[model samples]
Target: MTGATQRVADALRDAIEAGTYPPGGALPSSEDLAKAHGVAKVTAQKAVNQLAAEGYLTVVRRQPARVAEGPRRLSVVRDRKVYRDQIGYYFDQNAKPWGAIGTPTRGVATPPAHIADLLGTPRGRDVMTRTRLMAPKGSKVAHQVAISYIPVPVVAEVPAVGSSNTGPGGIYDRFEEHYGGPLEWRETVSARQSTSEEQTQLQIPANSSVLVVTREARIASGRTAVVVEVNETTMSAARFAVSYPIERDSSAGWSSTGGPRD
Candidate 1:
């Protein structure tokens, strides 16, 4: 990521963008790349690694790094609205294009610290987790990994959420149906370097970036909101982009900061 390494990476990226190396095409070896870029072999290798992490190239041991098949970038759009089917499948528009790689894997286990906190699970206690790996339908690349963690308290009330089959609408629908009505959702987004597992599943290289979306399912109480489930979604940052609408409001404009609302 230094000036020299980044300069080399930028040149290669420019070439890739320009079709100098078409998809699934092979790039020159590190030594050749170094000679072309007038950088050290190590610098060239770093550049290759850089582009690989950015989801451009695929690296293999003792082989030339090649362009990954498919468009260099995948634009994954995130929709804010949640939808439900009449038959009970609760989902969002963002998921319409993708399907699960397999049936959701479920288990009761101690969740990570952050997940535990989000689910309000007590330390040393376990939670029910339903995990699914989703990808664009018919695409070879994985799009995201979603894990939904439910507090034991909620699981106890609605045992279906703890099981592989949640009847019809899935966990969200079951939750709302059992709790009486609609459920509220809140999301917090952040970014981090891809984990080893994520890099393998997402087909990115080490140090690749991933976007993390942590969503909370809530129910309204008489005077407060209670969280029942936490869903964490991890997507390759190089391949996915979150989209949302911005509403125009004078009360939220810079004018509000300059003076009282007009």
Candidate 2:
């Protein structure tokens, strides 16, 4: 990718992050973006393709591209013991919401095979899904793009979904409120790739790197609640942090007196 591509990617990332292109909002066409950026249509198309591959944008057949919805504002502190379960496990008591806004986008078919496995159901099971672009607070750029899937049954209970624009508070909170229990456990796996759709959403240059994070969450009763899949181009400059605690030994050969040992 040329510097122009990077420039385009950065510009688009900012737009998504800042709510310029709200979730489910359509992005300008390649020709329009090219004219806006003073670049060739090919360059604009390339940049858009990169964003789409990274999960920032989705391209529908014969339809214009759109911005994906991202995570609601939630923060996780490193190394804190928040909760315990059957096994001794430490959990974060407080989660700071990342500034990513959640706008309901047009529902799409589930593509990845792993998502079906997480749902413990068939790939074509009428699952409810949404996509978002994530822009953390105090940041000028949008770093990550995410898609979430839940059983249709789960979403039908909320009734507020598929309509209205909800800010940083994501579906997880809504599910807990309506269903009566918080998400107790989550598992995540990450990788790197460039999908056709991500290139458009992230506006990544050709050959630029991207990251994918797949996560699953469940309630204390062992029922699957949500599956989140994220794709982010390196240009978005998104970062994630994790923390844990270690025990300290206070009795390690420290003498009460300041005298040297004989």
Give the Cα error of residue 203 in candidate 2, in Å: 2.0
For each candidate in turn, the TM-score is 0.66, 0.48
- Badly placed stretches (over 4 Å) of model 1 are 1-72, 86-94, 221-224, 250-262
Q: Write the per-residue lDDT of candidate 2 for residues 135-235, one digit (tens) a residue.
A: 55544444566666666655566755444553334455565665577655444534455566666666554443454545565654346444322221122
After superposing candidate 2, which stretches have Cα over 4 Å from the reference?
1-106, 137-141, 165-169, 220-262
Provide C-alpha RMSD values for all models, in order. Answer: 10.8, 13.7
The digit string of per-residue lDDT tens for model 1 on 103-208 reads 7798887887888887777876888888888876654456788888888888888888887778777887778778776788878889999889887676666787
In lDDT terms, how accurate is model 1? 0.78
lDDT of each: 0.78, 0.58
Number of the top TM-score candidate: 1
lDDT (Cα, 0-100) at 16 in candidate 2: 66
Residue 97 shift from truth in candidate 2, angstroms: 7.2
The TM-score between candidate 2 and the true structure equals 0.48
